[model samples]
Target: MQVKDGLTFQEVNAACGVKIVAPDLEKSIAGTTLHLANTKEQIENAETAIREEWRAIYEKMPIMCSVCKEISPRVEFIANCQKGNPCQVQ
Candidate 1:
């Protein structure tokens, strides 16, 4: 496999035959000691995009009751109406 920058030691171990002992230390001293196998900027951008997408979805629909497993309507749920109907179980 191709070894790039920013890849975790565990990931590199899985991809390659080499086993990493100290992943934390290696990541901390990346570029100086251990070379990364992936781009940190790419990973951060992907994480940001995923977070933004999830935030949008959460804003659209939030407050799912664990007991009833029901999601309340946006307005009623936001208003904290105790009389709100339970959502249909999947």
Candidate 2:
């Protein structure tokens, strides 16, 4: 098995430069109105719930490019511009 850096709500916004429906999706499911996730499990569960809840709009979900800082698909953003790469758009 491969060791992976666990994904969290903050990581998604800070690292990925994109936003999800909620910071704590599970907490939202549990009647949490604030976008706060206490634990990693909560974060993971919340993310999963977001995915499931938005399954119908999964393809339509907005994915802001961390490279170009635009609300576009990484592939499409890179393809349109003659940049370095998706992760490194120089």
The models' CA-based lDDT, in order, is 0.55, 0.54
Stretches of model 1 off by over 4 angstroms after superposition: 1-37, 62-76, 79-90
For candidate 1, the lDDT comes to: 0.55
Give the best candidate by TM-score.
1
The TM-score of predicted model 2 comes to 0.25
Score residue 87 of candidate 1 by CA lDDT: 47
Q: TM-score, each model?
A: 0.32, 0.25
lDDT of 2 at 58: 45
RMSD of 1: 11.0
Q: Tens-digit lDDT track for model 2 on 32-78?
A: 22334579998888777667665544444567776567686544555
Leading candidate by lDDT = 1
